[model samples]
Target chain A: MTSFFIYKAILVVVVFGIMLMAAMYSTYLERKVAAFIQDRVGPNRAGPFGILQPLADGIKMFMKEEIIPEVANKTLFIVGPCIAMLTAIMAGVVIPWGGELVINGVPYVLQIIDFDFGLLYVFGVVSLGVYGIMIGGWASNNKFSLFGAIRASAQMISYEIAMGLSIIALIMMTGTLSLREIVEFQAGGTGSTWNFWNVVYQPLGFLLFLVCAFAECNRTPFDLPESETELVGGYHTEYSSMKLGFYLFAEYINMFISSAVISTLYFGGTNFPFMNDLGLSQNAITILGTLAFFIKIGFFVFFYMWIRWTLPRFRYDQLMYLGWRVLIPLAIANVAITGLVMILTDRI
Target chain B: MKSLTGRAKVLDNPKMTFKERIYLPAIIGGITITLRHLFKRKATIRYPEEKRTFSPVWRGMHVLKRDDNGAERCTACGLCAVACPAEAITMTAAERKPGEEKLYREEKYAATYEINMLRCIFCGLCEEACPKEAIFLTDRLVSTDYARDGFIYGKDKLVEPVDKRVDVSKRQTPNVLEFKKIKHYRHNR
Candidate 1:
């Protein structure tokens, strides 16, 4: 038990470090992607290929002035970005990074926590993600920030419904709320029964979930809250120094979490097909699974950046319309169709 | 009426069809175009380490000329100052002493010359006005400076270095060279 506790502690630290590093580098990747899309060379001076740009940026963010509004609610203003970063880091706990690792004849799960209701736990924490934005925006005493806060809250709420519906369909098919079991259920046989990868079973659900994920992360097209033309810097408009850094970091971490969730729920998480045939050792397979998982996460991150540069922001009306009218209805129809198909096939 | 060039068409803002209204296909098309551009050659020159070739006749920073024998070409005739639309050029003429024949080609030479770059329009009118082939615009831009007074380029900034040559021959076209030759011939006559 003591050894297991030690393992868990190490895993927690590792996951936290990975989350922070990934968030930091996401900013660099965002700039590079934007530059590429526009046919310009981005930030290549700091280090080789500008890989150290994020480190430079972090240092710069740290060195900046931390200004709080004189008339603002100082306590909430201070707590806002702290809450944002905290919530952003908290969502990765239940995500299974790999299958298992056996060290000295003791098997250890690669995930930090594997609660039975892992899906609900992630959703619960993510829903609280809005409080950070709201508090920051409201406390700023700026009308633009307040408007952004309101929009953000409304957007998150509207999209959460469709997102929940989409996940509900997946839950019905998998019959478990645990993310680990969902991955296990999707792990198909070597011969070609590679039957899982929930995307095959729930293509429409995946699409709806993906669109909802974009909104949930407050990414482009759905990024009306932070629309520079409208709200300046939006929720973090008055935030500066590391406080502002925390808000931006929280956003990237949120993107990372959403990508992880999507890949786990639909793309088979860390389960690589035909691994048994390769005859790799158990520990080797675990390592390979983690690598495969990162590759999937990387692709999704790229997709986020790709679509961001590709698409323009939607009008506020269009955003609400899509969330309520388009995504919700599609998610419902997907759930119905999935239920009907499962019933007809007697797989329920 | 039809366009003389067969390219022009009537402009119309037609209603979007169902497929177009969805916008997915158009978005995908835009993404494809942008993706294609991702691999295309970038148009920027990156300034310091790399430079784009300037056009042969490109007018940039001013350069007071020197003949191949390294004698100053300006005769302090003030034609360039007179032709300057901005009136940015100012010069003080001094008679060339007998011993200074190797230094100054003409009997009269500009003792103190200055061109306020902030006021100059960079239209190459001064180059066109110079009868002595003394002034030409070279393919070097005036660098940025903090003080407004820094923009006032004196003879030290404008003149060609003695040991190292500054080439502005490309800017003197055949017509201009012939015109200079004729002007010199008329001056001698």
Candidate 2:
């Protein structure tokens, strides 16, 4: 038990480091990608290819003056970003990074937790993420901030239903709430007992989930809440110094976790095609699988930024229409069709 | 309303089709467009390291010229100061001493020549007004400085070095050169 605890502690630290690094570099990558798409050379000054940009940005954020509005609620304003960042990091605990690794006759899992209600935990955490924006916006005591907060909460609430409904179809097919189990269920290549990725089974569900994930992350096309033109600075209008950094950082982390969850649910987590067919040792295969999983996550994150640069933000009414009217119905139909297919094929 | 100008465009508020309403195809097209641009040549010149060349007739910083014997050409006739619309040029005349013939091309020279670059419009009128061909606008740019007083081009900043003469041959067009060859002009004598 002590050894198990030690391994888990190490895993936690490693995962935390990876998450922070990924989030920090995501900001740099966003600028570089934006510059490339616009036919301009981005930052290439600080370090080679601007690799040290994130560190410089972090330092600059820390050096900025911390401002707390006189009209704002002091305590909630402070608590808002903390909640946002905490919930963002907390969702990563349930994601399985890789398969099992054995050392000295003891098998250890790469995930932080394997609870049966892992999916529900992620959902609960994601739902709680809205409170950060809502509270921050309200605490600012400004009209634009309040409007942004309200829009954010409404958008998240409307889209969460669709996101949840989309997941339900996958859960029905997998018959398990544990993320590790779902990943394992999709293991093995062709001519094997297990199936391919869940995307093969539920393409519509995957599409719905992708769109909802974008909304939940408050990304472009679904980024009406913090639209800069409509709401100046949005929820973090009154926030400054590291406080604003935390809000922005939390968004990138949320994007990272959302990409991970999407890859896990639809792209078979760390399981790549012909992964088992290779005659490599168990440890080698596990390491390669972890790399493959990260590559999938990277692609998804790039796809998120790509979509962000490509699509303009949806109007307030159009956002609501898409969320409440379009997505929810489509997600419901997906769930029903998934059930129907399961029944017809006698897989249930 | 009746069109006042035929150039006015009448825009149609056409309803979106089913494909357009879906937005996926249009989104894909935009993505492909940006993807193509990602590989396209960047328009940035990366200033400081790479500078774009200016046009030959580009009027920039002023330079006081010299004759072939490396003597000051300006006789301080003050025509440039009079012709300057911005009233930027100022100078003081001094008689050339008997021993200073090597330094001065003429009997009179500008003892203190100054041009307030902040006031000058860079219209090349100074070059046109100089009877001695003593001042010309060079291709070199005026560097930025912290103080307004620093923009005042004194003799030290304006005069071309004796060892390294500034080439303003591009500003002297064929017509100006032809006019100079008339020799009837007092300075041309």
Report i-RMS for every model.
1.0, 0.8
Candidate 1: tens digits of C-alpha lDDT, residues B1-189: 878998997899999899997777898898898888789887767888899999998889999988878899999989899999999999999999989988999899999999999999999988888877789998999999999999999999988988877887798789877766664554322
Candidate 2 chain A has its poorest 10 consecutive residues by lDDT at A187-196
Model 1, residue A62: what's the lDDT? Answer: 92
* Model 2 alpha-carbon miss at residue A96, Å: 0.7
Question: Backbone clashes in each candidate structure, one number apiece?
Answer: 0, 0
Each model's TM-score for chain A is 0.98, 0.99
Candidates in order have lDDT scores of 0.91, 0.92
Rate residue A253 of model 2 by lDDT. Answer: 96
Among all candidates shown, the one with the greatest lDDT = 2
- The list of candidate 1 runs beyond 4 A from truth reads B1-16, B183-189
Misplaced by over 4 Å in model 2 are B1-11, B173-175, B182-189
Model 2: per-residue lDDT, tens digit, A1-348?
898889999999999999999999999999988898889888888899999999999999999999999999999999999999999999999999999887777788899999899999999998899999999999999999999899999999999999999999999999999999999999966675567899999999999999999999999988877899879978888899999999999999999999999999999998988887777778887898899999999999998998888789988898999998999999999989999999999999
Worst 10 residues of 1 chain A by lDDT: A187-196
**On residues B4-46, what C-alpha lDDT tens digit does candidate 2 reach at each position?**
8878888989999999998789988999998898899999998
